[model samples]
Target: MKRNPMDFMPAYFTVAFVWFTTHFGGGFASGRQLVEFFVQYGWYALFTPVIAIAINALVFYYAWDFSVAHQKFQYRSWTDAFYKPYERVFSNLYDVVFNLVLVVATAVAFATGGATLADVLGTPYLLNTLVIAIIMFILTIYGANIVRAAASWIAVIVITGLLFIYGSNLVVTLPNLMTVLNEAPAPRGFWYALWQSIKYAGLQAALLGGYVAVTDVLKNKQDVKRAAICGFILNAGIMVLASAVVLSYYPTIISEAVPVVFIIRNGFGGVALELLVSLLIFLGVISTGVNLIYGGSKRIVSVWAKPEEGEKSIKNKRIIASGIYVFITWSIALMGLIPLVAIGYSYVAYLALPIVVIPVLYKGITKRGGEKGKSNELDAMTAADGPKA
Candidate 1:
């Protein structure tokens, strides 16, 4: 099963795009999260992405290495790898809380997509919601390969669109950028702001398991290494650019519901702005929703399937699970976007602090007591068997 890293080039790109799209959707693209988590910190906010990149990189690297070593592609196995005596407790907690967050977050994405399409096409919200739900459900049933491919390429298009929007806005704002930076206030100190930034990144806990679970596709440490680097750059690069644009218009657009849309309308205006903004929101919502559903189903099906189950049987279970998952998410999507994102996202960020950040980072850094040997065993297995786990 192990092959040349060159042979897995597509997987590398798929993982990178999946990681980017997973975090880059809904709250993130809406510029709502950017305003609250990044721009609100004033001049120090510039450093927020730096801290986030570091934390994301550290956590991602550990997850990738650990997953590959143990041949653990599911979230439960991942928890078992590190939690051990407390694996049952932590795994159960993570499975419940992480899925809850993902379902709500995916619903937020679905709701946003529906609203954006309805706004653009003058269609009814219900019709838009039904269509979006159907499309997402179809994508989920196709499972990981199709989802990853769609998300990866769609992410490229979205990011390119973002660069156009943010890049143009930044060019215009650069004239007044110095004044904005000087006048921006730090409501909290730099250290506190930095802590908030790290917490914001940790809110991504729901996506972490799936992100690392892609190790099932990878063939070598070099592939995982390159994938991590590419993923971090794609994600961090966008965050920095988007944060700077938000900061450029800080204080003024801070209170807007979707600050980035406001900036785009002001700069681009008319049909062009509408097309761009609609595309951004619609694509962002679908990409995140698909990744979340795909990820959760992967983990859930892994939990349900017997160890000796054949690939076809496991896939059949995924189809059933994905259908049920999509229905629940669609129901939640009816709650709408603003309330789901504004209220729900921040609390999840705080919860992730202890549940995901501390335990994973501690184990990854310390390598723990017996984990080194476990890692070696994994390396030996990989060496002998050629990455079939």
Candidate 2:
């Protein structure tokens, strides 16, 4: 009755897809984040995705290695590793910053969903936000199990739909693409663009660390490395493709509330296809919101409850925490999507660089190039039931 090891392949891809979706979310899906961070840079944007991919790979590997080495799977453990005697102080700071950013990110997702609903179905913005928030709560109330069940499949479908939609846009724009490329403006310039890309990657790096912590139970270095590689390739490939599509229609679509949706609605030129793509993106936003709230609430529970705590008690704590997060995010979502992505995410990106990304890079650079005691420790931890709380 033992599960086949080969079965882990699908699970591994599922985790990979979840990792991709966690970062993609509403902002990326709508083309707002890409326009701000990448498309605005003109031809220089091409280089940014490569850099983001490298940083993503390093951050992911660091997260996985840290998780397996200490048998701890949350941000608190990273604090312990990096801050030493001041673990509590640093960890609490990380916890606060992370949760605050997560709240804002969830709100951004809600806002994106609301915008999509309004554009596609003419729904009121407030009503759309409320409906999305309620649905997110329903999914998150069940914790990571529900998120895990929904996220990967949602990611696959949405990403595939995006490819088709964006690819079609690219084809339509191909004849004028050269003219468009020549006229593109680099308002931020190359150096600023490079820095923005790095900062943006750092923002996602912090979340990726915590996500890898909560969702993946790392069995070995190979598992960690495999997931890291898969995550990086998927993240980079999708972002690059999405950015290319945005670049093809830049400046014109930049001011729109939901750029990608707008591009699809107008450019794709079919009512049914446009609606299907819009619905898929709206679902993607919801899925990302669910994953964010679930991950953040689970981390809060892990920090508050001891690893020895009973499952029922832990589950109750997660539901309560997720409920509070959902309420706050729903309120903040009314502030709108542009401000959320423009101001909130940009600030968090800078904060995350030094705190989360650098520490991970430092660890990777300094750790002895050998597994040594890592395997034995992981074995012992798994024997002890594996990071319970």
Off by over 4 Å in 2: 1-9, 306-309, 368-389
Cα RMSD, each candidate: 4.1, 3.9
Candidate 1 local lDDT, 13-42, one digit each (tens): 677787888787777877877777778778
TM-score of each: 0.88, 0.88
lDDT of 2: 0.71
Supply candidate 2's per-residue lDDT for 308: 60
Q: Rate the local accuracy (lDDT) of all candidates.
A: 0.72, 0.71
RMSD of 2: 3.9
Candidate 1 C-alpha error for residue 172, in Å: 1.4
Best candidate according to lDDT: 1
Residues 333-352, candidate 2: write the lDDT tens digits. 88999999989888888777
